[model samples]
Target: MNSLLKCRYCGWVGGKSDFEWDHMDPKIKTESFLLDFLQGKLELICSGCNRQKSDKTSQDYTFWRWLFPRQANFGPIRAHTFMDTLLQRIHREIR
Candidate 1:
């Protein structure tokens, strides 16, 4: 499956040799690794991007996108959705 996949986070297009499978929600932080894997929360990313993203949750990436605006593939529409989700999560926590 060489070059058949693209990095979802960094948009890197390359062969399988350069790609790495990263768990978007991070298996280490989640309750069950098997559950996370079975839930389809994994993504293919380039080695460099995998290192840079490094177990950061989607919320973390959302914040990083706000600060850097050039780190990954968080576009405007996606950013709006992400921020909305983030706000909802925060509101729930505060309540």
Candidate 2:
């Protein structure tokens, strides 16, 4: 059996087909930056979460939901960890 993958944002577990690529930061549009981002900065999230996060950086999306209690769906701790790990990886890659 194939190993299941979890969506970093929503924690949904499923086969690879159930996930899609998302950029950790969506504002950098340079070709070289995109290539670098594709190497490791891409996030794997479920379609629903991806659609909800469209055009927004992970930080913005998380913060917006956090600022408004009614729109929050996932746990804050999990989202914080995800952001922390992602930022660490990005920093390491840049150094």
Candidate 3:
């Protein structure tokens, strides 16, 4: 039987076909290109969640929404870590 993976951002769990790889730490402006590139910094996430995450490194949800202006409303059905980050951001915004 094929093993199932759970998304750290969203609580989605299913077969390999149901998920996409998300780079927790984007390789855009890292100091060591080769090291970062070769490292296993990927996490399994739903395709829908991947779209919202894009290349953003920040775990902040509002920032995520802002990053993908066109898909502001689009996001994981239930992102556990993302929601935690969102709650943190909310408090920061309030202050």
Candidate 4:
């Protein structure tokens, strides 16, 4: 049986086929490409959200309609933690 998975960005829950892996930070330009290789840099989100996010980082509000409402489902604490982890990963890549 195919177990259901939830989108880390949106609250969409469905089978694995409905989702795709998204980079937590998509704007990183690295010579060795170490950023994508790091842990906590990937998230499983729905294909629709993935396409909407495009190459923009989560910090970018270009897709506010898709991002903000869905993020609210995470509540304040989980949302803060999510953003904190994303920022930490970006900082790690920078240093």
Q: TM-scores across all candidates?
A: 0.53, 0.60, 0.49, 0.54
Candidate number achieving the greatest lDDT relative to the actual structure: 2
Error of 1 at 26 (Å): 1.7
RMSD of each: 14.5, 17.0, 13.4, 16.6
Q: In model 2, which range of ten residues has the least summed lDDT?
A: 71-80
Q: Tell how far residue 31 is off in model 3, in angstroms.
A: 13
Any runs in candidate 4 off by more than 4 Å, and if so which?
A: 29-38, 61-63, 66-95
Candidate 3 C-alpha lDDT tens digits along 1-95: 79987766556677777686666757454566455547756666777777776677746644665666675533344467768999999999999
The order by descending TM-score is: 2, 4, 1, 3
Q: Point out where model 2 deviates above 4 Å.
A: 32-34, 37-39, 68-95
Local accuracy of candidate 1 as per-residue lDDT tens digits, 5-90: 66665566666766766787774546766676777877666776667677787568657756886655421123457689999999
Q: What shift in Å separates residue 74 of candidate 2 from its native position after superposition?
A: 7.3
User: What is the Cα-based lDDT of residue 71 in candidate 2?
Assistant: 60
Q: How much lDDT does each candidate structure score?
A: 0.66, 0.72, 0.65, 0.66
Cα lDDT, model 2, residue 74:
45
Q: How far is candidate 2 from the true structure (C-alpha RMSD, Å)?
A: 17.0
lDDT winner between 2 and 4, please give it: 2
What does candidate 4's lDDT look like per residue over 1-95, in tens digits?
A: 77998876667887776777677687654444455556567777777777777787876633575546754333112445668999999999999
Q: Which residue pairs clash within candidate 3?
A: none
Tell me how far the alpha carbon of residue 34 in candidate 1 is from the true structure, in angstroms, after superposition.
5.2
What is the overall TM-score of model 1 with all chains considered together? 0.53
